[model samples]
Target: MKLSPTFLSRIPALFLSCCLLLAFGCSDSQDAVEPTLDMDSKANNKSANMMKEYWVEINPLNHSGVTGQAKLVVEGNVLTVEVWAEGLEAGMPHPQHIHGFVENKGNATCPPPSADVNGDGLIDLGEGVPFYGPVLVSLTPFPTAEDGTIHYKQTFMLGMGDMIAYQALKPLQNRVIVLHGMTVEGTYWPTLPIACGQIMPGNSMGMGNR
Candidate 1:
């Protein structure tokens, strides 16, 4: 038997392809055996149950006269986020954010009533943010109702940059959501956090509570 130069050259390429395929297969096999998102584990990072819900109701801090709730839910590959409130300044655009856990050590808690250490009034956003780290996602604003009710809704992708935040959210027994008032001098109150919510597993809170 005589082997051609071309056949000899092809042998190396073929061998490399087989090796690469074998490596890929081994990696995938290992990954397949691993667990997926754990919905109940505080240590896990992701959860997917179609309509599984997690949210929190935030009381008025800083005496801004605002109260509302933030809800995070999964419908598909996107997370349906909603922040709704009443008692906020009418026609005001509030800046809201999904704050991370405090240093990723544990769940972020809403500042206790005693957090108002100054004895002036309420617990403002500045004082509250430290407990909840930076914004994970700043949602787009929806129109505020004429009656002083503000609503913000946004859907975030669960497969990209948002995936990191979405995954981290599952472990948090507490979620810190902040809404920044428009200006220093609001229609009724000064520019501050009109409303904030400490979200967890639950249904959307009705306006009656705000």
Candidate 2:
């Protein structure tokens, strides 16, 4: 009718062990709930859908020196502008970019890099509006040599939507497309828009219009 000393001693150790196990068990359970990327499953399901597709038809206005078509694709914030020229030679940088609220081709110069029209210091929504001008995202200058056929592509993420969306919307409201010109000491211009087009929106791809 008496508990053994060994048994009594073992009860406390057993209870302590159980408590430790429960604590660790709950901690492990919580850790498992943390988010984790199912990369394998995603990789299996991933297809062309991840790739963005867009088509922009650019034409020159009030100028005969430059003309052509440009295609673009937006994956997230990065924009890839591809130029397909008819009579353009090879080796030109093209000096191209997106201007916010641009009125005319010869009205202003390409927005200088790190330019903040709103003086907000941060290139966020509404910063590139007041200037309301074109920005040189990327360019393919006049062919350095003679290729006879101009075809160049460039990628850029100028933080436009994140900074100049409001200003960009105005120009975009009227089928604005990509514009190309020249660059001189980060301040070239008359950006004689050589190639131009209207950005058309489709089901899978198109301009955000803002």
Instruction: Name the top lDDT candidate.
Output: 1
What are the runs in model 1 whose C-alpha is more than 4 Å off?
A: 1-50, 75-77, 102-105, 113-122, 142-147, 159-163, 182-191, 204-210
- Clash counts per candidate, in order, are 8, 23
lDDT of 2: 0.39
Query: In model 1, how many backbone clashes occur?
Result: 8
lDDT of 1 by residue, 34-100 (tens): 2444556753433343467776776776566777776777654467887777786665444565555
User: Which residue pairs show backbone clashes in model 1?
Assistant: 55-199, 55-200, 56-198, 56-199, 58-196, 58-197, 62-122, 62-123
By TM-score, how accurate is candidate 1? 0.60
The parts of candidate 2 lying over 4 Å away from their true place are 1-52, 89-93, 102-132, 140-145, 158-190, 202-210
Q: What's the CA error at residue 191 for candidate 1, in Å?
A: 7.0
